[model samples]
Target: MEVQYRSQFPVCSFRLTFAVCVCVRACARAQVCAGAECWSVHSNHTSQPSVCGHDDDAFKYCAYTITYMLLFPIAILSNTGALVVFFWKCWHRSSAFSVVMMNLALSDACFSLTLPLRLAYYFNRGIWYFPDWLCRACVYGFYLNLYTSIFFLTVLSMLRWVAVMQPLRPQVEPVRMARVCVGVWLFVGVASVPFLLNGVTQR
Candidate 1:
């Protein structure tokens, strides 16, 4: 009886181990199925599992299309509207208000011009097909415009404060406003000189 029991113990243990393995496999399959269903319901955009360091052209295009289409239209419409308003106000009644508005509009327009190149860059994964000088110049010009816009806004606020507080004093005249705008632009250009010297082929 002892010999018979010892012989049968190994068979019993093997059967128990097999049963546990089967149960675990079944549970794993069920969990996988449940996860897939949950994700399917939650996500509208379907994508393959990402492979690390893989340059997926399809995913790149999907992202690029969404970003470019949305941003380009908004930039165009908003900047164009601003430009029209600036021109209208400046032509009829040029003041510190008009100067700041015009400067802001110019900055937006200048920044808008770079969107195409930026969109192109996304499509090509940071590759630059445009001229090196032009790209650097664009970057330089964008920053210059931004800083100039900020400077004008600050100046505009100061002028408005002075005019409101001291009504007897003369307001910011057109000639003086023009001079300040020109000075801002000139300083911006000089500040951006480093970009022109650096060129565009920055890695």
Candidate 2:
């Protein structure tokens, strides 16, 4: 029985590999039907669905378009409220934690402001009507926001842990925390060079 299974295994593996290869080839040259037009997508290099098509059904791309649409308004409102509250509290009684939270809200709010630009590509149904330079900036900002959020969240976690572990110790000054936030933004911006040098691409 074991020998029989071993003999069939290679055949099963070959069939699976062949199926995947066929799917990849088909997807590489797939032509999407969009109303009165059709376009062939030869390759998709970006994480976003930089695909070929213009249709009312474009937002059918559940991954990016719909997600961005939902994210835009919610992020804007929530972050704005957070920013206002943080600013008011920090103004009256500043602390390292509040300073960090303020910066985080500011970062998210700024990023949310760019959501419209991000959605422009999707709302137009996978087409980039924005200027190439603007496209590159948006792309850079996407990555910058991602890393900045991660870094800020990490800093917040560490600060909380420090507070818990050493409740009696003097809290770090808000001034220094603000400086750290500045340094984080600078480092993230420097690290994420705009893709304009490579030329913004659309499939």
> Can you write out model 1's per-residue Cα lDDT over 1-203, one digit (the tens) per residue?
12111110000111232354455455545554452433332266765453223234544554554555566667677767777876787789887667666666677677667767767876777678888877887778767766876786687667667766766776677767878888888888898788778775464
Root-mean-square deviation of candidate 2: 16.9
Which pairs, if any, clash in model 1? none
The residue-by-residue lDDT of candidate 2 on 28-123, one tens digit each, is 345444343333445574343344544424424333555567667777777778888878979999987787777777777777777788677766
Clashing pairs in 2: none
Clashes of 2: 0
Deviation in Å, model 2, residue 57 alpha carbon: 10
Question: So what's the TM-score on candidate 2?
Answer: 0.67
lDDT of 2: 0.67
Q: What local distance difference test score does each model get?
A: 0.63, 0.67
